[model samples]
Target: MLDVRASLGECPVWCSNDQSLYWVDISAPSLNRFDPATAINTAWKMPESIGSFTLRKAGGFVAALRSGFWLIDRDGRLERKLIDAPYDSTHHRFNDGRADAQGRFWAGSMNEKRDANTARLYRLDPNLKLSAMIDDIMISNGLAFSPDGRILYHADTPSRTVHAYDFDETAGTLSNRRIFIRFEAENDRPDGAAVDREGCYWSALYRGGKVVRISPGGTLVGEYELPAQCPTMCAFGGPDLRTLFVTSARQMRDPEELARLPQSGGIFAMRVETPGLPEPRFAG
Candidate 1:
């Protein structure tokens, strides 16, 4: 475990080149790099809350911050502003995102006020073009793509449902949206997710205290109980991509609860049988 104690840790991405994990503390508003070998974490404070980010093909990162999309260099310097926040920055911000196999970046926004379904999903092409792909979303989360790149999985956290879409990697589009999985338990709110090479979708249940593995056919096949009640996201990393790293949150927790779960905001990891696909880099 990496004991960084983040406030709202999310978006764990594996950096195969350096054999390290990159993640963010949304509430802390910082970018972090964790090295498993040394158990050392490096951080970069951000001007605004950073929702998610992915490595760039050339170098550095393509991030979705509260203000908008940006190009940040390896040294944490903002290189350029890709676009302004498409929605009102006061009520909405980018939440979950990743790059597709084709090098296109996709991100979803969330309605912080929760008063309406005003959030939307967007796509950022390699040429710096931005487009809104899906709309009427509340809390956008659980963004992952199948290994074959033909399916995209997403979840609206407050709705407790995960959805799948027929993805067109070439044209960078989605179609035939359908319910992939729906949680009946009140605590099983789907958050961030990852797809293993076997096509199994692993989702971190926000308040459920566990990560569930769902079969490609939308069946709950396995589960991994976590020490923290609020695991925000998970990523597969390590030498062979067999280590499943999970990040959790400590924001707003009662003092007693925090004492009971001291590792509430720390990063945890475990071995897994099926390896995960290498994270795709933003081509732009």
Candidate 2:
């Protein structure tokens, strides 16, 4: 497995233009970028907790912070642009996010208190406005849009299932919620997910020690086992979008377990047969 040491690696995203993989470490308060060409790693420290991010149409990225969403310049200047989430408990914050075909940003939250229901999902526009999409989320993890942008896929950790919604691209609305796929409860819960060009879902299991490739009809076609327990997220990167980059986490592990798995919090890579859909850009 390709190794990328991370403390709590999450939110893996592929930047085709740069041919690199990017992700965040929320607990670590850092951002990561890996250059496949040189096998090099780069990290940036954040002033506060950062849940996830998406590419901006103009340049740079839009990131979700504990307080709200913000615009991050190429040089790492962070400007808080959205403040509508004041109701979010301080213990809970933004988590995984993905862009819709129309360039709107969709992100979810997780409860820091574990069993509490203070979490929710949100949709943010370039103008820095926040809209609540779903409520009572336990842990908003990975999210992705369908190849045709007609379906939106989302997963809440420890739930063991990924949910699908009928996406209204023009009106930015979601309906017809249904369970798309379910992972084994004995295994890790579904943490993050991505959709391939063929519309297959690539879901990373948190403690399951594997990533499962499921058909749109909910059939398991394949699996990729990982050396770590908490594989958080996955994204397809590379010149041809055939490389799968995965992020892992060290949280929730005991000291002994952490010692046993040195690569537990690092990133992993593998080659895949199918290419991934082009990541939708943020409307901003």
Q: Candidate 1's residue-wise lDDT over 169-268, tens digit each?
A: 8998999999999999999999999999999999999989899999999999999999888999999999899999999998988898888888899999
TM-score, one value per model: 0.99, 0.95
Task: Give Cα-based local distance difference scores for all models.
Answer: 0.94, 0.82
Report the error of model 2 at residue 225, Å: 0.5
Q: List, residue by residue over 1-284, the lDDT tens digit for candidate 2.
A: 44655667888878877887778888879777778788787878898888899888888888887877788876567865656444555678888898888888988988887886678888887666678898767898768878888988888786777899999988888899999887767675988889899999998898888888989888999988988888988998888888888899888788887787878988888899999877887987
Off by over 4 Å in 2: 1-4
The number of the candidate with the highest lDDT is 1
Instruction: Give all candidate RMSDs, comma-separated.
Output: 0.7, 1.6
Output the number of the TM-score-best candidate. Answer: 1
Candidate 1: Cα lDDT at 210: 94
